[model samples]
Target: SRHAQFAKPHSLWLNDPDSEQDTDEDDSDEVEQIDQDEIFDLIRSISDPEHRSMTLEQLAVVSAPQITFNSKVPDRVTVEFTPTVPHCGMSTFIGLSIRVRLLRSLPERYKIDIRVKPGSHESEHALNKQLNDKERVAAALENPALLEVLEQCLSTAGRST
Candidate 1:
């Protein structure tokens, strides 16, 4: 039986050597720092919850240009995503998917900040709040139904390019 529901989306691919990118951090022993393209690639293939056949990249919900990290604060990353519609009810789930993807793929030291693009969602502030709140995010994932759906959305992220 495939108990993917409890699995992290990036778990399967994390050990794949081909999936690893060479980073130019301070030293070889230093933790690898990922760039915008790497971040985009990690999430570009995430399957949209509603359009199962389409990816977040294909749906234009997430893009490399929308991902950023300040040079001085390389440990902090901010990803702004746009909902397909201002009233899209799945904004929170979409944000969750991004958060979970980054959380699983990036180094533990990386501070991932997932948010909705300004004016992109009617509840943008609330969405950002939920996504950034560790407690709320944990609570959301604790819900079996949401976790199952999240697993489904993330399962397709390992597609070979």
Candidate 2:
């Protein structure tokens, strides 16, 4: 049941050549911690708005190291993405894609934090604010043109609703 709930398998077991078999129930199984690779896979296939031929991964915008889940606080997930160019105009949309992907894939308890990687974009703070703004995100998603673009980007990732 735990395997079914997780994207990757959660348990592992190894036998020692000279040691007695461990029979402790505590050693029976351990769940793997959710990590950045899992987060990366969720958004790696999102297509860049400017370069429809390239996914964000190909453009080096989204990376695993930039994604972090707070160990002390299981409800938080922060993803920082870089644009192919510092002046790339689609940074906001890229952030939106990451946000949407996580929203669809992660549990409701997760508080997603989507931002532009520091020093990677010209207007990083403003763009981060826009991307993280609940009101702005809601308004942007309501616009048919914007939603269309998001759908186009996500469709390639096999996650568009």
State TM-scores per candidate: 0.79, 0.75
RMSD (Å) of each candidate, 1 decimal: 9.5, 17.7
Clashing residue pairs in candidate 2 are none
* Candidate 2 lDDT by residue in tens digits, 7-55: 2221111111221222211111222455777768778878876676788
Residue pairs that clash (backbone atoms under 3 angstroms), model 1: none
Cα lDDT, all candidates: 0.73, 0.68
Per-residue lDDT of 30-117 in model 1, one digit per residue for the tens?
2486779888888888888777688999989999999999779988999999999887767777788889877777777889899899
How big is the RMSD of model 1? 9.5
Ten-residue region with minimum lDDT total, candidate 1:
12-21
Judged by lDDT, which candidate is best? 1
Give me the candidate number with maximum TM-score. Answer: 1
